[model samples]
Target chain A: MALQLTRPVLRSQPRLLAAAQFLPTLMFATVAAALVELTLLRLLSRVAIHIPDVPALRGVYSAAVQAGTVTFPVAALLAAALVTVAAMAMLPRAPILAIPALALLGAQAALLVAGESALGTAAHQWLLAVALLAVLFYSTSRRMALFVAGVGVAQAAGLAQAASANLAAEGGRALPLSVAGAGESLLLVTLLAAPVLVGPRRWSRRDVIAGGVVALIGAGMLFGNASTARTLALWTFGLGMPLPALLYAITAGAMAATLIALLRTGAIERAGALTLIVLGGFVPPNSYQAGLLLAGVMLLVLEQPRGPATTD
Target chain B: MKWSKPAVLLVGALVIAGALAGLTGVRTATSQAVTLKAVAVADKPELNPDWATWVKIPSVDVQLTNQAVTYPKGGGTVPAVSLKAVHHENTLYIRASWKDQTENVPSIDMAAFTDAVALEFPGKSAVSVPSFCMGQPGSGVNIWQWKADAQAGAGSAALAKLYPNGYADSSGFPEELTKAALYQPAFGLGNPVARTDAAVQTLVAQAFGTLSAAAAQDATGAGMWRNGEWSVVFTRPFSAADGDQAEFAAGKNTNLAVAVWDGANGDRAGQKNVSQFVTLQLSGELVKAKSEDWGALWFGAILGGVLVVLGLAALGWAGVAGTAKERA
Candidate 1:
């Protein structure tokens, strides 16, 4: 009986520790991304000479700098992803792993160069696809899960800060409330599902309770703000949010959840979940384009013969 | 090795394509040209020497002349004399001629007979007239003048009104020549003097001198002469308007000619005379001629070429990058 109790406690301890470690990485990634973005903006101002008005150029430069600053969390995840991939590649000694790893790195580079322009709906979908592929090719389930959870948390924090900053700059009450509502909804959903996806298969009472709390808080925040709540209700009623914002929100949520899950479960399940979530967001309103991609990934995952399972 | 060959070929092709695109952009940018031209009108006396020529600009082919014709106190005014053949670029000049009929005309009273000239440009609706006259060779000194409204009945009254001392219709007066001298002490024309033909000539010479001084002060002032003859040389090449085309007119007949030259280079381009003469009822009127070509294409081409080069460079870079990626 003591052994059983100790085993469960020990299993949960690593997840908690992993979650803690991932948080700082998320922060670092956020700062790095922001710095890179700011640098790009400065460079663009110096080089792009077509701008006629000095004030307009200054405004654009400032906006670029702000966007760069907001991109830190995403940058952190990218860095973490790279490091994890590198570690995995070293452990497996597979030359092919380098290809996918390099591709991820390339995608991150592209995202950095493109700035906010790259965060459009199409780009988010592409990133989602890449993440899914990475998850599949990952040597260890733990690393994949950790990647997802780390990305999710970082995205949540970064987007929340961005939305807040945007609201403050706009100097209006309504926009802030609406943005906060959306961000909270995203945070709650991501944090709630993350533990389930990344934690051990047999969830303990604490994990279940944590998930419930997160869900409750997230759902409450989403519903509390009348405007955002109305928007979501509209979406629920078969209406849809604007494509770009919706894609961004969904991608951010998936990344947060995956990162959280990775922290908890030490498995790659969060990666697949993130992929599904992003794919769902990418599907056009009243159309099923993304469904095909999702189906392919699912098929691939299912085609892999089941390996023997061991009790945790 | 096989892929490398294909990649190298692709890169080469891209670079070539980029270069071509850049050249094309450059060609389009430098395609348009713009031009501007300036012209000058000669003094009226050069067109008709009887009139005192106030200003002359040879570079633009302008000549102006002014003269007073006297009528011997007799029956039926002498038939208006058609003086000289005024060139198209030149205008006939005229001045108000006064008579001192009073034997006891005081030196101060002689101020009423102030001699003044009126110059009219063909295209301009208004005339230009000088008001007060100072002593000959005097800088900024007023020599002789008449009270306001002294010469109101003259044909160029509107032109005369532009002068400071000339009669202004708004001021209630008989609009006739007044014995009171309109000399301003500020301009050094305060002392009254006896009215005689010599006085008139002195006044005329002084007026010409003042006008010449004024023109010298102005950036656009054409040079003038004390005698009725004056010429202007342009610093740059210029073209004249058709009405400003150098011409000679006497009574009903007029001859037109094109004047071309560069004052700076001391090159007097050949003058071309027109075949047809335009006859008008009026005498001593101003005419102008305008030139056709002005050079501005060089600047346009230079600017366009620069833009094209920049655009081409960008396209080249893109192509090079694309080619490199393909090869890789």
Candidate 2:
């Protein structure tokens, strides 16, 4: 009886990892991307004001800003429309997976397009991170919940600071540190207490070493290469300093890991097929990039784990 | 006679492979964009001052912003660009003209914004267009960048010979006051006053975010700013294919994307007005253009080989399984 229970616990670990990490990372990326598009809209509007003589350009700007305002609902409708058609036409074996994914797709898309202002955008991204953490990864363990909350809250704070210049003050002192205005010096000191505030959890030697290395690298990336001082390594969005390359890399790694786990559940192929189609929308691939997709599909097929997987 | 399941499987695999190959061929053929007609000219006209005649590429909006969220909104009502191309022996010349009131040429000055125009070509075929801003990964781009500063620098050198020291204004509201911004120069190299136009540098990069600088300059251009508008002509070799740079050839349509940067708006890297992938067809030439089908061809070849191997394995398994079932 203990052996059987342990097998299931092991099986559920992968699912738990996906819920906690993969979903939140994607949400974070989506929010960042949404912010970029919104920035463009705001810039175009300002330019239009100055160049009123150019009527044709004015029309284009008007159309772009107008279309973007309803970005969430429209994008969700389009996604749902496609999903509904695809679910009907292909008659995919795993409609159950598609159904939940379809709902999340809409919800995620809607939250991603949350507009209003910097506060709203930050709030929406935070809500998304927290919601995904709770729904997907939230467990009975108090430490795990606290850890997830810490990461989510920190990311939320960073995102708000990233958007400070653009959302709160357009063309204001845009240097990342100054983007948040004059209060960063004190706030910085307070925020630094985060790692210490996590409470005393016993760490293994390996854990201690790993944590130290990560913290050092994170600090180096944050302070060493200041993007404001002409170092292009870091991008301070609005006021939040989210490292895009790091985020996307994490997202890709998480997605790949999740797909591997799903292979055991006999759901990877179906999910991968849908994912492949959706990924095309994001990165317009040339013929060579197409090869990566083919290889990925083949790998999923070959590496599928046999028998019922023990679950967590 | 009824066909065995093993035989049926082999035939089905071959049929599917053949159909895929045929469909791919059709897609490749359709991918050939409309050829841009280039007027063969002598000396690839030097900043050919006349703008009345150059056949224009669709002056698409330098559409910016809203693709991402930002505090300050994007899109500086950038003017649509126009294009004219002409080629001589082993050379392709492109003239890009756009409307810009201020002459924001490249400068070392902290606040000087240089106006620039660039032509981006796919490293390979006419059909395999990648991202609009830059060539996507796996596919590289050859970029021919022309800046207004270079043109102005070249003109400044000429102006010295024509009327040297005549327009010299030494009083820059004091160099100390403005922090060493006083533009005063003496004759010869170190003359602070005689900073001739800087040569617009040409660059070759494959993707959107690149930090690498150009080691060699290949293309040359000249720009004229008059009455709130700028016109520039850029020239590069026709068959200069080396490394990651794409080769431009006569009689073949090369998929190309254009971008114009107005420095005034802090447009660098991803910021600027851009155009969708368009075709730049050079009309006549000495050498016929080679095809850009290698990428697709290799992909198909590998796929075909895999299918053949899988088909063989399937057939063998079917045969063994069939015999076992019969025996049982």
lDDT of 2 by residue, A1-312 (tens): 000100111233343322222222222222332333334432343233344458798677656754443332222222233233322221122222123323433443443343122223323333322222221121123332343334333333333343232221111121243323323222232223322322223323443444455545545544553322111111111222223334322333333333333433454343443243223211111211121122222222212232222231
Per-candidate TM-scores read 0.23, 0.36
- lDDT (Cα, tens digit) per residue for candidate 2, span B1-328: 1334543443344334433533342221111111234545544354464633343222212212211212122334363565556677767767767777677765555566678777777765433444444554555677777776656664545446445566776764654554343433232333322334434455555443552334445666777778877777777787554655667665565666677777777665455666555545555532222224434643663365345334433443454455447668
RMSD of 2: 21.3
Interface RMSD of 2: 24.8
Predicted model with the maximum lDDT:
2
Fnat of model 2, as a fraction:
0.00
Q: Model 1, A16-75: lDDT tens per residue?
A: 324323322322332333246335532342223334549977687656644532342333
Every candidate's fraction of true contacts kept comes to 0.00, 0.00
Candidate 2 residue A156 Cα shift, in angstroms, is 47
Residue A111 local lDDT, model 1? 34
Could you report the DockQ of all the candidates, in the order they appear? 0.01, 0.02
- Cα lDDT tens digits for candidate 1, B133-189: 111122122111221122222234434444447654585544443333443242244
